[model samples]
Target: MISIRKILCPVDLSKGSLLALKFANAISGRYRASLAIIHIMENPHLDIPGGETGAFSFGELVNLYKEERQEEIIDVLKQKGTHAVDYEIIFKEGVPYKEITDTARNIKADMIIMSSSTSEKSEKVAGATTERTVRFAPCPVLSIKTDHDQEKREKIEKIGDLMDMSPNVKRTILLPTDFSEHSELASNYAIAFAKEYKADLIVLHVIETIAEVSFMSSVDLPGYGTTSIYYDGLLKDAQARVKNICDKAIEQGIKAREYIIYGNPRREIIDIADKESVDLIIMGTHGRKGFSRFISGSVTEAIVRNAQCSVLSVKHPEHNFV
Candidate 1:
């Protein structure tokens, strides 16, 4: 069994963070784990001419600000009706990602929970803090998208907040792939996860109709000219690739299935996840090497922000998740 003792959640008090807090609180409650809520107290920006020379810099004011944040978190917990779970809110002054990683390592945390917040410093997809921490953090990170609107949250929340629907339940995991290095890496993790939980694995490959110009170049077809003929070939190719992946999982003693669909990657993925009621979605933040890590418009990023299940987004440069 995977042992989760302590969970560390980093928040910036945004709506995104509030939604993430709901998931963290639910998971902590289900596992009976200790939850530590930490907020990085960034030094306030002073636009004055002698701001740097002042003795009363924002660093000196962190402790006082920390107290205020603590009270704010308590009020949030109350407002959100999350009083059942025991949590301690702490604050630190430093780089957001660095502080979050250090706090997780220092406390020997089993996992880090955070939101994909939009910041001016980082691209809007995975949030700057979340992207950096996922690559370097000592533990696995659970990043929820702020794009989940109220209706979807209510629907999934009623399902017991993603993976914690029931203890040791036979889970269904969705792994969407574009056959990139990181996507392959994510598949390995998904297969292992299925084996660990005796869960069923769903291997999906989306033949994007809209993102076709870029994607179709890579996929080898019969070189057909007509649109229908071209798509038929692409669909056939995707089906084969997806089935082979499912076979790999089945060989590893896991129940597995394959689904190939042609549509918008993000939309199809979410639709299937909701249809199958999958407990988890394992995918990569960056799939193709040609794709920029900072590309906020990637399909994985879209799914991250909209999946009806918990998302485990893997970056290429990452530590092993035990």
Candidate 2:
């Protein structure tokens, strides 16, 4: 039921953003998802303390920049569109990151596809914009570089309307879970993707570390019954989690299977993806911040760096958790 039916591609009219727009167009053409193109002007209200004295009047400045950026964006869109794809462009004033996130939420977009600068100045090719958008987006965000000659790909009005661009889940899909609410959320997406393509769903949950019992039971136990009991609890819980996920898929009448393993989360996630020959990995992030963010979890970052297949990282809306 969770489908990528609507997509948001926020552009700043940079060459990279334009490349992102083309990529979004390809994906939207494949799935028949609506494309909402957004442009956000940087907020002008804030300045360093006592640094605003020489600033121009707000109204005069606003009108001036608006006319300039709006014209440029319109020209870019006109150049980008072909006869087949339908897209809507939105111009708003606010913080780039906030407005992008807000518009995606308002439109209930299933994904956000954007281009990242591969400029040497950027430490990560994914870029800070891509990272921030991924951190906050309610749906999947595919941050791709401007590769693949666009002149070669055909065009379509809708995503599902085009068979060529339809993703091949049959080849592979990498799923990572921490056994959290949002991890289950990623499972929902992965299951649907697998079902659609009739692909093998390699459901994976890593223990992150060997359990204390497993570590202590180095020597053989007195009876196999007690040892079985110890492992049973962990496996039982994992089975139930996997069952709940599979149940959602079964409701859609799709055949789905699962796997559970023990190891470091990031390494296992990448390893299984490589071993299974997956095309994508769908996982979840908690989006923790500040000191807590610094000291603890960053499975998304690790997997993104190490994964061979594409990674789709999902996070709950802020309100969804609270």
Candidate 3:
């Protein structure tokens, strides 16, 4: 069984953040997890003349801002009726991603939930904070999209209706894998979520035809054969692996299915999710950094950016809470 004791959610007070808060609140209630809602105040570069500096010190201005933000957050939580689960509001000043990740580590958070989109006035590029947090967060990160329907947004405005509008994810969950250790970790989360929501699970593996061609062009190595024979063998092997995973899910009382496709893994994953009307996607990230991340370009990040449904990016934690 999986356990989620603590969840951290960062909000910038945008409509996007409101949408994310909705998910965080609902999931926390479902798991009976403690929730910490944080807001990071970016330093405002005040170019005041020396003469007017005495009117209010920078520290005083920050304090004033924090007071206003606290009131706003309290009102938001009240409107959403977040009394079902234990929750706290934290205010900090610094870089958004750094503060969010640090708070999660400090709280030993089991999960981090936040919006994948940024406000128009944000200084950083769109999705930059979310991308950074996903790469560096100690635990799994679930990012919600802000592009919901107008009707949904309207529903959000109605006080005490948040629980009804929150995502239940009771339809289908999509998990894309390459069968690596990272993918194995993600599979664990996929199974846990499927059981929790009583949702069907779909495991998909995509074989890159370009890689197949590369393999075929190699010199006839020992235990190797013609291209057609090699392709058939590869397909059979993938089927067995995918089926094994589905079998495990079935044993856990989950409705599960497997799929094997030939194409780019990233593109195929997103396309299939749309075709199947998947409610969520759970996948693993290598947490690639610096030059390697730039060169290879993370497939998980690409999917998170493009997928219509929410995405949960899991990384192996030092302590396995789930």
Candidate 4:
């Protein structure tokens, strides 16, 4: 079982971030976890009090901003009726991603729930922040895309308006794996969430047949006969592995199903999530960086940016809280 004792939610007081707070509030209430709301001021400039012209010292500015941010958070929580939640407000300066991740590590946060920018243009820039945080975060990062689906956002808003604290609305969760150790780490989270919400689990293994064939053709392979034969063998192995994962979920009293698709992993995963109407997608991130990541973009990041539902990006952590 996974236990979340502390949840860190980083917000910028944007519409999307505040919407994310609703999710944070719901999950914190469900897990009975202490919520820490951290806001990072990238470049803060506060006017002197009483319309004074002199510049305030950095320490003085930080203190002033801290009090202001605290009041804003408190007012937002009070208006949302989430003031009763066990929570604290944290204010920091400097880089947003660095501060957020550092705070999570400092507080030993079990999870980081935040929102991603929804606009196509802004998403590219702001998505980098989310992607970086996911790469360095000590625990799983659950990123909520506020503008992905209108109906879903409306539903979440209604829940907040009604002060409904029941957060386990996830009925179907999609878990895509490539049979790596990172995927195995993500599988643990998928199973735990399935068991927690009593939701059906769909285990997906996507075979990049085109890429495989291209790589095989480029190299001098020995035993491999034709692409068809190689693909069939790979498909059989993937099916078996997926079945094993589903079996484990079933053993834990979860309704589990397995799926094997042959196509672009990113496209297939997104299509399946939309087709299945999945509520959440939990996938593993290899934390790839620099040249390799540039050559082959991350499928997990693509899903996080484009998926119609919420995405939880899991990286193997030094400390196993889940």
lDDT of 4 at 227: 66
lDDT of each: 0.71, 0.64, 0.78, 0.81
Top of the candidates by TM-score: 4
lDDT of 3 at 117: 64
lDDT string for model 3 (39-78, tens) is 9876432423331456677777667667777777766566
Q: After superposition, how far is residue 72 of candidate 3 from its true place, in Å?
A: 1.4
lDDT value, residue 72 of candidate 1: 66
What residue pairs clash in candidate 4, if any at all? none
lDDT of 2 by residue, 217-307 (tens): 5444456345555555677788888877777777766665677887678777878877776766778777776788787757786665555
Query: Could you give candidate 4's per-residue lDDT for residues 1-322 as a string of tens digits?
Result: 8777888999887777887777787777766789999987764454336324447776776677677777777766665444325898887877888999999999988889988775756445556778789878888899987775577778656644433325555488999999999899999999998887778999999988665356345443458766667777898999899999999999999999988988899999999999998988999998888999898888998898888888998888755557
| Top candidate when judged by lDDT against the true structure | 4
Q: Clashes in model 1: which pairs? A: none
Summarize candidate 1's per-residue lDDT along 87-144 as a digit string, tens digits: 8887777888889988888888777888875543333533766766765677667776
Relative to the true structure, candidate 3 reaches a TM of 0.85
Residue 101, candidate 4: alpha-carbon lDDT = 90
Runs in model 1 deviating more than 4 A are 1-7, 14-19, 25-37, 43-60, 71-90, 94-111, 116-140, 145-171, 195-200, 209-237, 251-255, 274-279, 287-297
